[model samples]
Target: MACNITKLPLFRSISSRSFASAANPKPIGGVCDYEVENSTVNGVLVTSAENNSPITRVSIVYRAGSRQESSDNQGVSHVLRLCAGLTTKSASQFMITRNIQQVGASLHCTLDRETISYTLEGTRKAVEQVLPFLSTVATEHTFRPWEVADIVGRLRLELATRPPQFRTVDLLHKAAYRTGLGNSLFIAKYNIGKIGPETLQHFVNCNLTADKATVVGLGVDHKELTYIVEKIKFPELAGQPINPSPYKGGEIRCDKGGDLAYVAIAGEGAGHNNMKEAAACAVLQKIFGTGSSVPYALDHGMLRSSIKVTDSFAISGLNANYADTGLVGAMFVAPSNVAGQITENVVDILKNGKVTDEWVSKGKNQLKAAVLLASENGKSVVRKLGQTGALTGSGISPNQYINLVESVSTQDVNNVLQKLGRNLSISSFGNLTCVPYLADLK
Candidate 1:
């Protein structure tokens, strides 16, 4: 049963009750009571929200990512993000971890294709005390010589332990873009020794700038949070300025190891603001690749002998939609012998295109259910809000998402499929033995 926090008078009076109930109940679909304040920290866009709740979350998102790096600096952005937690002006990595544990908080950073986010979550009281430390790390981290060497050593260890096939994904991106937004992963086994303290420091200095930053805060009193934010100071942003842009699409393929061939075909689709098109693209993915209950199967009849083919592979398809551009693709991991046939069949399905009214309705319902489930947690809510605010400069309510999904129709799905069918970029990652068949997609 869904707990209606909005309907309860007790919850209305006690802000903490709303957070306590959020874990189990579906999120309330209305405007958040918190007020947002926007400012610039030496040109960085900082957004903060104040609420009466005890827990608070602070996130700093930057535009610098793997996509932004030049070929020579392919992995620098990722490396910088990882090293952000290691050394700060006020504390060492050990002290930061200890302090966070004592306060029941956590600090971490994540790097994606287009963005790097540093996040901290804890009690409001704790966060108020901790914000300065976080700011120092964000704005003034010092990459010591010893720490740089240690980080490189650890990265080398990871590369040695990981399988060769795993690296092919990075290679695929490198080949596809060939330039902007298509660089290699940081800390490759082949490149660890090449990176040193000077290069890492240069990377940090060049990429960590106000022009590329976005700060988001949730669950703290807005007035108090605003005060804290206003008091903090940052040096003037340096380096070349960055503006948001969409990723251009092109083919990228890699041949590595294993008896089976893995293929991922992708194309540019829609953005967050294009709700109808995004929903349509999702429905297109469901009808073509999602084997769940829809009973769609790969051409080679599951290819049981292939190592990459698991129960999960049968239902897998890529439906990643972003703020500026999106990727819609289908992948199949099948035996080397049948890999060509599977790719052809998958393409055939895309070309034949059968998006009926029933299929459209089912996809919409499934997508809505998934969104509802994801929005139930307070952390998830904050993350969603942060992404929306950062990417679109607007906040979306849960009800708005539901309404948008429900509004999609069969014609929209068919339209999306028709567009994807005509223009597509396919990528494959696997063995050299499987390379010949990949050219067939062209």
Candidate 2:
């Protein structure tokens, strides 16, 4: 599965990478230069990105996600995501929504395999106006039984509407990790009966802790945000320590029976701990490219340029980093007739593709541009801080990220490629009858 750094709540439609090749790139809107303050007050980790803007976004980020789930509690994180705007212990759902709407604030819930974030964005006054409610929602939500049932129904509808890419990526995760990271983000239809309000509440109570959580403020006064966080009461619960899940490379195939076949070819990638290799993998992703800039455009990227596929097929490189492990790979979407050819071609590129100096320079610039553009949003800036702190126990600023990308050489790219060898984790969905198997690719 592709690591989707752009699929967040705020960055959905923002295609910042398109301008990577600009001869003279202009500074993006919002504050690029800012100060970050990290503190541990009463055991709660508080981080704030002070910047100039009328809008303030406060996010409560937790280290608990699907990776933290076990077989008994699979899909609890997804349930918790659905329960974000539900009733808190001190307030009703109606009052929470009415008050937020009254103040013209926006509330969003976003989660991945390793993290979950609940954020509120609006004017400073609107933020302060609803701080108490937001606090309750994050730290003291009362998962009502009826509300759980309602959200579960909505989740089912969402699952129905999800495209082939979602399923394909999900299957890819399953192939790569086998468990933990392999667990699907969307709750399985059968697992719905297994999860309930109590299950979600237990998961939250056991996994959500001050040490494993960070309260981040963006485009807001640090002093004010710190004060607000200080005044709020949080349960003094300790989180359970999670053992790292081993990466067992394998394959998962599903025949959804569609004209288009989806395939993911992956290998082991750098974990969050290996910052250098992770940075190198990021450069490698840019070197190979992820999908076409425009629809139905081939030769728009290294992967597309190298893979001998017709216009009816598409290929892109994908990399996902986790706290303890990662996945580096490519995905292909093509008519079933040529799915095997496209899959084999992609694997061939990963195994023996050459990395030139020109590719390295271009990839470095593209990675640098992506880093700068991603920092444009205050929310993203703070999210990075929380994620870094949660995953790696440190934060990477925009300048630091640019420097890291700048230091990536052709040798580093080649080294990363060598590390991600031919022992690939493969997944194929949608008319898998025409897709190639792992052994068949060889």
Candidate 3:
């Protein structure tokens, strides 16, 4: 649960009022500020907030990511994100890293399908000291030639050793959308090797821009943070807004090598703002994959599986909620021969939505219990808040989301299952021999 942001000591004694001023007034956007400041940094919306503590956490979020790239530039956002952590023209990465460490501060960046973020955390004093460096890395990193070579070498090694991690998701996306922004994760090995300094530079210049960025600083003084934000500038980018082309979901199949077959079945679900439908989908997924205590035979039996749970093969249900789209998926690693049987069994469980009141009640109770556990940590709280704000442009407390989950009825779960049955996308990775069994599911 350790996030990309750092923790510093200087924030032990600050008050929210430290940032209340005319120069940095409340934001004008609708429902944009949630214990934070919402402003436009070079035409990109930014959010900042203050806690009683003296620490300030700054995060720069952008809408650019793997989903924004063309087929030829599959991993461009990921490469660019790593490059953002490297040395800039005005300073060495080591010197800046050491300086921030001296003040008990840290910085990190993460790239996902829809967004990339840069986070900085430290005490007020350390944050103030490191803000300019953060700004420089954010807007002025040169992506030097030697550094690009070094990163590319490392990336190649990673791809070679860990191709499955990238390939699994990449293939899943391709399976879902045959063409458009979603189906372009696989860039040929030759193309990956050919990514040069110029390629990285062009990627950074074209994809990263103020128009698609959001800056969020939490637990800080708004006036001071606004002043710091105002000083940061980047060259204006001229182009049409990056609109992800529409996707029409379909099946995708591929073969690699392994004794067991790995399968992922997904379907379109509600977005973050569709609270009711989203909650229903969550309950539906839990009923199908949630652990035994629910009185569901399938979940109880799966929990009782004699197969030794390897650290890598822990089975779980996944619900990924995006701004515009969401995915509800279940993954299982089973013997190659039984892979088809498992998929069919799972699909049958989803189609035959038979949940008693006890099962529904238990699922709700389980979800509520987990939320209570997550609230004890400051980092989890901050992350949950940030993610909700980023996705929905609104804030919902943990209790609120739990309430929604608890309110989902058996009828709701059945409705979601019926909806899912109509639209399904499945992906299998392993030996080609296992693929025949999986392909028979449709």
Candidate 4:
């Protein structure tokens, strides 16, 4: 969403329109600055911001997310995500862990359907002290067979503990795209132990390349970041060509019996390629409702406002953007007996919801707060900003994001709302006896 990039001395301005090859394959647009200056270094895209904060973070983001997985290598991304601290060519799992903890730094591996990011954060001097370890952990994965097998239990634990809402959204992606972006972030049970060391290595060799990655840093110098980035020996090419995954709507229902129903429905949304439209979708999500930001606070969201039943139910709008296409809609949780009605109400509102000037104004305010609050998590901001520069040719400053939000008018929001239910995808999980089918709804 947004990142705070405070000014630091000795930060020279470098002029750049966009990344060289960072967007080479599977490029998702939405090229705006993360309040960081962008530059291209040796074949890699580097984006960094200077700050006075003692904490510093640097992340190497590869385009190798779940979307990169093919039929033969499903769930490799999840396994790879868990394999972060495992043995690398340069260091053992024990040493990697020991060294990072020793420096009071944290190493994390996170992945979405689109990108997998490896981040190292600590005090500025501490990060500088172990900078090479970041590259070693990210690029030099050996994926020893024994080491890979040991983490299967961790995968199982993850799957078993996921909440219903997570499963519903994961299923929603499948119903929406059926492939590519539809791939699950979790490893399917069948693919559990089948993905061997070779499969892991093959996938990385083919999809994760230096040219297709972006380096992002916070509280760090551009020259220092660029210099280190050039030395990270990322995979040099000869991998699978990343393809654009378009949205194709459909429906899926998993009758996983339970007392409540988890349902998610969405329609085609604006992709990042169109800045105004994308920003509008962000605002539109807020307009419809994203529930209360205050924990344990009453939710008076627009989606909740229209519901007649007072039964325990939860609702929130969804807005997900990618390079080529996106999905916009809502998810609901309620007693199975009333699930259908709540879902119908959500769809009714989505398809016929009116976007007024006042609603749009409120949405802008909510969107601004959401972006700014998200930026508060320094690590998350760096991760989201990983590939922005590569996707779009250039960027705008922090103040300009407010300008972008302001640029979205009521008409633009309504334009997005009108697309709802056009090519809709509905995913329902849990006790689905009362959940309506896509055709059953008006």
Predictions in order: lDDT = 0.58, 0.75, 0.60, 0.77
lDDT of 1 at 114: 60
Encode model 2's per-residue lDDT on 1-442: one tens digit a residue: 1111111121112132221121222233446876677777677777776556667778888888888898898878887887777777777777777778887887877788888887887776666667666677778867777888887676787678888887888998988887888988988888875688788878888877777877887766566656666666666778978747778888899888868889988888888888888888888888878654467664466887776665567677788888877888788788988888888888888888778999888888878887888888766686788787678766667887787777778898898787677578888888877677787666
TM-score of each: 0.77, 0.90, 0.78, 0.90
How far is 215's C-alpha from truth in model 3 (Å)? 1.8
> For candidate 2, which ten residues in a row score worst on lDDT?
2-11
Which digits, one per residue and each the tens of the lDDT, describe model 3 over residues 147-249?
7777766566655765453465566667666544464433456666566677767766776677666667666655666565565675479522555544355
Write candidate 4's Cα lDDT for 2-101 as tens digits: 1111111111122231122122212121222345778887677888765444577888887778888889888999988888878888777777777777
**Model 3, which residues run further than 4 Å from truth?**
1-42, 48-56, 161-167, 179-188, 221-224, 234-240, 245-247, 290-314, 354-357, 375-386, 432-439
lDDT of 3 at 439: 41
**Reference-based lDDT, residue 148, model 2:** 83
69 in model 2: Cα distance from truth in Å?
Answer: 1.0
CA error at residue 23 for candidate 4, angstroms? 32
Q: If the candidates were sorted by their lDDT against the true structure, best first, what order would they fall in?
A: 4, 2, 3, 1
lDDT (Cα, 0-100) at 193 in candidate 1: 57
Candidate 4: where are CA atoms >4 Å away? Answer: 1-35, 294-296, 393-397
lDDT of 1 by residue, 113-213 (tens): 66667777776556654565566666666887777666676566555665434454454444444555455556455566566667776766776666666
* Candidate 1: stretches off by over 4 Å: 1-55, 160-172, 238-253, 272-275, 289-315, 431-436
What does the lDDT read for residue 31 in candidate 2?
65
How does candidate 2 score on lDDT? 0.75
